[model samples]
Target: MAWLSQYQAIVYGNGANGPILQGGRSVTEQAIISSETRQAPQGKMSALALSALGIVFGDIGTSPLYTFKTVLGTAEMPSDPATVLGALSLVLWTLFVITTVKYVSFAMRVDNDGEGGILALMALLGVKKHHRPSIVAVGLFGAALIYGDGAITPAISVLSALEGVNMATPALQPYVVPAAVVILLALFAIQSRGTAEIGHFFGPIMLVWFVAMAVMGVAGIARHPMVFAALSPSYGLSYLFSHGMTGFLVLGAVFLCVTGAEALYADMGHFGSRPIKLAWFGIVFPSLILNYAGQAALVLEGAPTDGNIFFRLCPEPLLLPLIGLATIATIIASQSIITGAFSMTRQAIQLGWLPRLYIKQTSSEGYGQIYVGVVNWLLMIVTVGLTIVFGKSDNLAAAYGIAVSATMLMTSALLFIAMREIWGWSVWAAGFVAGCFLVVDSAFFLANLTKIAEGGYVPLVLALLIYGVMWIWHRGAAAVSQRMREALIPVDDFMKRTQAAGIPRVPGTAVFLTRAERDIPPVMVWHVKHNRALHEHLFVLRVEIRSVPWVFGEQRLTIEEVAPNFWRAEAHFGFMERPHIPELLAASKSLGCTVDLADVTYYVGHETVIHRDDGMGMPAWQEKFFAVMERNAVHVSDFFSLPNDQVVEIGRQIAI
Candidate 1:
């Protein structure tokens, strides 16, 4: 068993790097170089647009499935004709201002070197090396919002779609919860199977769904043509100010329609900025607006007064079929948000803002299907818990938009900075755009705050927990490293003592899997002392992960032979990626016979951190968090993908 494990690690080394090693032979020519000279496979703009439209917009696209229904269910959205029209107007205009004008037309153009999303924009704006603390907090909060959304997306999306079944047939209403549970469970259960296999069908299905939404809109539009008047901004403004504080309160829930807009930019790297922009303009935008308008029209024409506005728009004969399609759309929508959460976590891990979690890549072709077992199960528990606690889509709706609105506000702030610093745009230009974004986003954010007593606190509480853990992890890691620096054994002193003792030299390669980017681990010093000789080639590798999701595979790893046999390779991974060191070692060997794995011995350094008055920003409670995290982190040998027999573990003590 031990020999088998050793051989497995050696043979599988670099297999994760994708085909660099086959039949134990290195394929240097086959390797993909991550440079301008290397071009990604191309596709037609139309195909790319359709694909991006489906994958990126599912969450936002399916908002029409329940946003209007949920808003109308609220007490603030009046049953009266005037106020109802006003409320509908507000929803429509909010979509235009926030989703269409602000994000679709403007924000999508502000790319961070062809990368988008909150973190990439932050990086482009130089968030880290400058006003780091404040910007990092903002980024963390933005990240926390995604986590909050992740928990609720499955519950809300699945429940809303399932509610359509009950809408179509009151007989099925009794089975709604059970049906929803099964669908939600199935959605998550397939995550480990990788999305690429089924991913191709996503676009075609969504396109059909959008057409169905548009057709439903056409039906309602014929009945009440005047409902198109909601496109004017005056009604929205009137409703916002006329109804006083109550109208202001409903803005929070109204903001739910655009909860998934950020995802469009976050996933820009996958399908390219142009394709997403085209899809939003050409297909997604019109269908969603029309669907919402159709719902308003249906309500005006005195259609049976059912709660599910979306499914109600379809003809009676097609109700069940529409429910089936809506359920599929909602599942895709939930899948996008869940995958988005995975991407955000990966970015956070790379930027040193998150504790390393076990990340498993579940795809051979598509980068999207990733399973973080810990995150997946935890989110499932939270999602199911929320479903039971809230018990209905309306209750969950109250908690939905608060985190998203806050994150949007943060993105606007970061965008303002990026305009001034990165693009060198004039202050007035940046301020003008920033001010409009702030006004709209701030209204939604403040409105959400009003719902704290009504379930909005869930996400806020979750965000604080997530933020605290991140802050503590960063502080503790820094403190531990600082202590190591102070206690570092100089290379000269160690060799003198080991040589004086006449220790026998070991003739094998020693590999230490380290986490630090700059500092050498304590284990490296000890390994040389105990053996009294260096392997033919000694390496100190640093793996750097970028904050963006879906980094090109070839760009995923950066290897440098910093010194003779002293190589430093920084493995870059998306949050959904799994780390396999043996594969990296094998890949490196293929590049050149710089390090010999046949005679190699892997070394891992294990550290135990003790907390003191450390003066790191943490309170006593957070110190305990650090203790818990240390206990749960993957053990050294297991984490390094090393053979236990050949592996040497060195323990170091540090006080945080």
Candidate 2:
């Protein structure tokens, strides 16, 4: 409650969640409030914009590789000037409305302390674990869908790029899938090394790739300027009316053009909104439009509809070189998704939605660069399996749009909540903005649902499994915390009783890591009760991870002396931070706490969970699963970066 009051004052300027404080004063009455106060670092705009091209645009940039080809082949309509023009029109407008206007112009403004994503949006709405179950479930499900996208994006991107080889010679078609598998395996294998060294080249390579796309598009456009007619919305609308169900079904393939739109918002923390927006309007957007237009022009110029349209647009002389570039572009796209998964996993762990895993910070300067072996290998296996199962990008495309469409819908819903809560928008204005996105996202989602029998069920199944895990973890953790809170004794009262009982005091300091800072940890009470002794200097340290990305040094630790030689220290960290107990203790000197880091012995509680048939809040099966997960989770010593030899774990059994 104390921390809640403090956080409220920091976030809302008054200790309340409402838009107005006492005395009839509006929260923003003093000055105009902007969407985001934290600007990107100064003097790095050019460099950051270029970097955004590589990281932020990779997924969407590479979409032109397979989008046109899949649309033409999947749609029941004949590949004529009308159909080609109609499809290209839909593609252009989808990019404009979804990526350019919605995400770039709107969602980027609603961030959690400069971090953007579905999870960040959820946090921005101030939803915590087991609170607002429906909203939290929506955010978690949306985040889970991204993992499904992460798995399928690499498979489809790499396979489609490799399929360009078959365009040169049908004889090499058999090797396409194997080549894609090899490339994907190699991509995942290098994830542990981090991308800091090789990341610099991503911008240059994407620039070259986009330039080539524009040039090739111009060459095709020069042959037939009539493709420009597709710019009109009439062709798209007329095409849909002319052909009833087939026209609507074509949207499933059309959705592929903006599959990576979410990445633009999700990666806003990495490159900032300005740089990402600049890169989008400057390079990525123009190139994609021209390339899609070029593909349409080629189709209208009497090119074969059965062959790959993207590859066929290129001149014969540069076909192999184009394939090489496409491969690199797809690999970069894959890397973006992998890195995103790592970042999301870390956020989930810090927010207590999931258990701790082994996280390695890949770069000291880049807080976004991280590697999680569990997520990496799991994604690799799923991606490779999809490559083998689908066998071609055409089939993988069926599984792709379903997850992204669902995620987009969820984002719109959360954004509606943010507009009302954070932006203090009226219900009517927020509904108008959210309603538009909902219409587009829901249309795409329904269109993709038609492809369920055609491999779209893959991501749905994967998302459900992930959602189940997250929900279980959240519920189990809350239940355990509740049981611990009920059993805990007040620190002051415990100290008084111990002193009155004349317990012997030991020599060195004993640091007990706990969750509830106001109370003596159950492990400490148990230890004192059994041994009838206490440390001369006892510290009950509780680490609280805030929703923001970084915490200042001056506000990192808050120390309070509860009694003589007894202190309760609350250490604050951000979701992006890793805890180093020794370093934190050394920094505690600023708070007037004289802590000997070398001489301190860490005490951590280990819970042995038991599942019973009693009327606890959870089912027996869920309790058993939670017990197993708790048993296998990473130890407190390693998670806190404490020395293993100096760490003592006291076990306690609890029923839930």
Which regions of candidate 1 are displaced past 4 Å?
A: 1-43, 75-81, 304-306, 492-504, 513-520, 528-536, 546-597, 612-620, 635-646
Q: How would you encode candidate 2's per-residue C-alpha lDDT over 364-398 as one tens digit per residue?
A: 33334467888899999999999999998988888
Tell me how many clashing residue pairs each candidate has: 8, 0
For all predictions, the C-alpha RMSD in Å is: 6.3, 8.1
State the lDDT of candidate 1 residue by residue for 256-331, as single tens digits.
8899888777776555566677788888888887888888888888764447778878888988888889888988
Model 2 local distance difference test score: 0.80
Q: After aligning candidate 2 to the native by TM-score, how far in Å is the CA of 522 from where it should be?
A: 0.6
Off by over 4 Å in 2: 1-43, 553-555
Lowest lDDT sum, 10 consecutive residues, model 2, at: 13-22
